[model samples]
Target: LAKTTQPISMDSYEGQEVNITCSHNNIATNDYITWYQQFPSQGPRFIIQGYKTKVTNEVASLFIPADRKSSTLSLPRVSLSDTAVYYCLVGDALANQAGTALIFGKGTTLSVSS
Candidate 1:
């Protein structure tokens, strides 16, 4: 995966919007980003953030700029249960081609309060 930088922590309240960004300066032209949300004692949730496709799910929306060097995961009206560590990793498409496993670095912790 390409080197990425994300905020160490963020805060939000219920009914408020939350946006977490990640920066990957050296990303390839064809690279795709896959986001993951992990809560304590639970596995990471998958979110496909592709450059070609616009993905908008009930949980969140993934936005990538034209340069593909940065991305933001937008969570609309989150609740307390939404608190988790969000991660963005580059080269997910590459991993699928090579059958490689995912390696997650320290992600941004989102704390949602009432």
Candidate 2:
């Protein structure tokens, strides 16, 4: 299993962009690194996923290094509403696997201000 690590917190102003990076040194071949964003009371929402390259969506872009040891999540033009906890999950790619659980650690808290 790949053990993941990330920053504890970040500070950003409204309308600014933010990027959070995560490290997973022992990532397995069957494992995928996923990024999720969570607000104060809501569940973490899937942001992006990648194996060994870059993946982008309407909300964020995930950049994986060639070694697959780390990844970065880019958030464009963050706002006050974007302030939340960001988590990086590393596990099996199979979503339906009953044995797989999204183990979340203390996420990076992005504090967006005016």
Which candidate achieves the best TM-score against the true structure? 2
Give one digit per residue, the lDDT tens place, for model 1 in 21-97.
88999998767888999999999989656674457877889888878888888998899998999998887575466
Candidate 1 lDDT at 105 equals 80
Q: Quote the positional error of residue 4 for candidate 2 in Å.
A: 0.9
Which stretches of candidate 2 lie above 4 Å from their native place?
Answer: none
Per-residue CA lDDT of model 2 for 1-114, tens digit only, reads 578899999999988889999999888878899998899889889888888788988999899988888899999999899999999999887855566677998889999999
What is the alpha-carbon RMSD of candidate 2 to the true structure? 1.6
User: Model 2, poorest ten-residue lDDT window?
Assistant: 93-102
Clashing pairs in 1: none
